[model samples]
Target: MARMATHMITGAGSGIGAAVARRLHERGDELVLLARDAGRAKELAGAFPGARTLVGDLANPDRLSWAFSHQPLPDRIDSLVHSAGVVDLGPVGELTTRAWRGQLEVNLIAPAELTRLFLPQLRTARGHVVFVNSGAGLNAHAEWSAYAASKHGLKALADSLRAEEHGNGVRVTSVYPGRTASPMQAKVHSQEGKEYDASRWIDPESVATAILASIDLPRDAEVNDLTVRPGH
Candidate 1:
């Protein structure tokens, strides 16, 4: 089946990535879904029928490189969404070096490496790069120091890429969504010693819609950043 558009999404096994996959599939786009767990990625892909699934730990550069080397990239991708991330929460005083390094590797370094790998394809199509960030990227949240630091670093990555890639016709957009309802949020709530309340969080579907809006922009226009928060 020749599709009108093709998009690649990281973290497609669940949460926002899975939502984006379904939404893109609904829009008649072909997909290449990447997930850390092979079984989970395949199960998610099954829902979409034709979506290709690849399993690679984005935190490991060598492994990620090897995985991409084996799996064929689309000749021209319409969009690349970096939604895979790990969050480690602790006060700065109690944060261990190992914990900090782990978050940085998965949240910051890995995404950079993956983005670099896709540059050639993205440039070929003048495609869009979307980084799914958090409000933590915009400001510090108490006890979320390590996670905030990683997100801040991610925001920097997006800024630098946008300025550098713009000349190549590759548009970059960072989405800072506040308190989205997901298993991750449930974990955060546990750390905060608060009961998880799904109603207070923004739906992942809304963030996925925002990504599509950025991709839908005319060639002459680009959405540099999109920030969404629940009305709480």
Candidate 2:
């Protein structure tokens, strides 16, 4: 019998991450969720019984190596899904350095660090790496400089990793979803002073399906990038 696949996921608390975790859990795959602290790790553990949780704050990417060193990591990781992110919208002149740093650390640097730490397992398992990036990663709009810049960096990271890991039998994919109807969307709406409407955007489950498709593909082929936009 084939061994069960193990996936290490970030942002499993809500949104697309939650949807992805739910699907994987339901399908009997193993999950390792990344949490910012012990409390959050406990919460995720409760949410997904039988799933493991790792406490590593994405806000401080520099600390992840040390953090993981202190914790037990999975010996086999079939996939690493980076779905956690932070967004603070502001014009270039108005955005604070803290805001820029926060987004960059969470959306860009942390994923890179996490991937670096897990490359050995990934290469051994011939695993996949999925990056949940935003449409902003492809295009920057007004008042979205910092967030977009971070996402754009994420795109470059994914692209470069894909190139570098191909020889190792590891696959890299980036999913660029247009504004999804999630808490993040609500927050973005609030920041824009616009009334929130969840119905108009793509569903998190849809994005999850796309992500799973990439992960489940035959080893002979790989999905390099997937772009999902709202139907409406």
Pick the TM-score winner: 2
Q: What are the Cα lDDT values of the candidates?
A: 0.87, 0.96
Against the true structure, what is every candidate's RMSD? Answer: 1.6, 0.6
Against the true structure, candidate 2 has what lDDT?
Answer: 0.96
Clashes of 2: 0
Please provide TM-scores, in order, for all candidate models, with all chains considered together. 0.95, 0.99
Best by lDDT: 2
TM-score of candidate 2 relative to the true fold: 0.99
Task: Give the Cα RMSD of candidate 1.
Answer: 1.6
**What is the C-alpha lDDT profile of model 2 across 75-115, one tens digit per residue?**
97999999999989988889999999999999999999999
Residue runs of model 2 more than 4 Å from their true location after superposition: none
Model 1: lDDT equals: 0.87
